[model samples]
Target: MPETLLVLLAGLAAGALNAVGGGGTFVALPALVAAGQSPVTANASSTIALVPGAVAGAWVYRRELAPVGPASTKSLTAVSVLGGGLGAALVLALPSESFDAAVPWLLAFATVLFAFGGRLSGALRGTLDRPLAPGPRTVLVMQFVLAVYGGYFGGGVGIMMLAVWSVGLGIDSATGNPMRIAQLAAIYVSATALFLAISDARSSPLVLTTMVAGAVAGGFGGAHLARRLPARLLRAVVLSTAVTMTVLYFLRG
Candidate 1:
């Protein structure tokens, strides 16, 4: 089979997986590497290509954004955008081996969070409505750190954001999804911009274009399903996929 056709197929599969489960990188990354791109280049290309999908997914959930208090949204957005730039810079500066070695550990940590995240998030939801008024400083700090991680590596960030927003910031999952989507979109935009300005992204244009197209389609579908689907099943699927992909990443390493 032709490489272009193969990439487009992989992109389609990745889009569907990402929409449903948020592990699209697990598909696109390997496909890029197999097609002879270096791991670092593949990672950068994948991040760039995935941005449009994330945006589409976020737009699907845009209605959820309406109810969030403006102050909270503004605060999180600021931190996410700033942190994304820092993370992208770190990715550009890191040695390829170091980045590769870190991927497994990051994946493992995200998997663990997804596993226990439900109970934790449930406990915090009650507090979200009470107007406790915790300062934004801590949330900003955490967002910066997470955005850096997201921009640099780009897997499981959604789960991490869900946990943080639900548990740390005292937001319910339903409201948090839109906020998370916005934050992630900011991070992706910042990171992609930095990568294009300073890194070598020209090497994988074909792969990038096809993957983005697939992700955009899948994201729209996923968001639509997310609105209608039961939360329990969505959480279960997301957690299971994250764990399985983490294992795969470790084994591949």
Candidate 2:
């Protein structure tokens, strides 16, 4: 019961964080790990569990979605889907022992990316007075790579997407927000589909179902609250969570 409750709360916070910014994986992945799942299974399960929330967030921003530079929304989404599938396959192919050893370092890397993503985006944006105007190919390639990472271990994938768009396409975070959510949904959707088909995410049906329900509710509510809540407050809360979770994972290791 306690484990169930913990995951339920984690799902709520993870969904809210994803809706407000992009740190859902940081919350969901660790929670599943703590629930006694192996790192590989936890990662796959977390990805599956968070799919609904990302989709809900995407729906909320549907009308506002924009293309990344020269890439149309359809094109970007297609690349994200393909890349996500590949990443999921990679995860399933890895041995459990290898994945377990890598989890802590992955969490630390994600924490750093989440912590500095904004400032790094700003710095890169400042270097160019105008958007880099990378051709459609370059934009798609960058997105594909990020999508691969998103599928494999999503922790700060959203922030990385925003940063890439800001640097390569001269898109500001606000302007790119809708696209970020959309692409995240695309990646998660593809990844989850793959997970459900071949992974053991279904092993903990109760935990997964509870988290999904909470994520959906939280994602919807968070989308509405996003407009009212201060962005700094949201970012601070997520960063703290990410830091704490990363530390715990390292200690466990």
Best by TM-score: 1
Compose the digit string of candidate 1's lDDT tens values, residues 1-253: 4777766666766655665656777777787787778877777777777778778877877767842333467777777788888888887887667777777888787677657665665555556655433466766777788898888877777767766655554554455665666677788888989888877777667767877777677767777776676766777777787888889878988
Instruction: Summarize candidate 2's per-residue lDDT along 1-253 as a digit string, tens digits.
Output: 9999999999998888788777788788878988888778888888888889888988888888887888888999999999998889888887556665676776677567666765665675568665346899999999999899889887777767765665566565566767888888889889999999998889989989988987888787777776565656655654676677668767977
Q: What is the lDDT of residue 93 in candidate 1?
A: 85
Overlapping backbone residue pairs in candidate 1 total 0
Report the alpha-carbon TM-score of model 1 versus the true structure: 0.85
Candidate 2 clashing pairs, residues 3+ apart or interchain? none
Q: What is the C-alpha lDDT of each candidate?
A: 0.72, 0.80
TM-score of each: 0.85, 0.83
Stretches of candidate 1 off by over 4 Å are 66-71, 118-134, 170-175
Stretches of candidate 2 exceeding 4 Å from the true structure: 96-131, 229-253
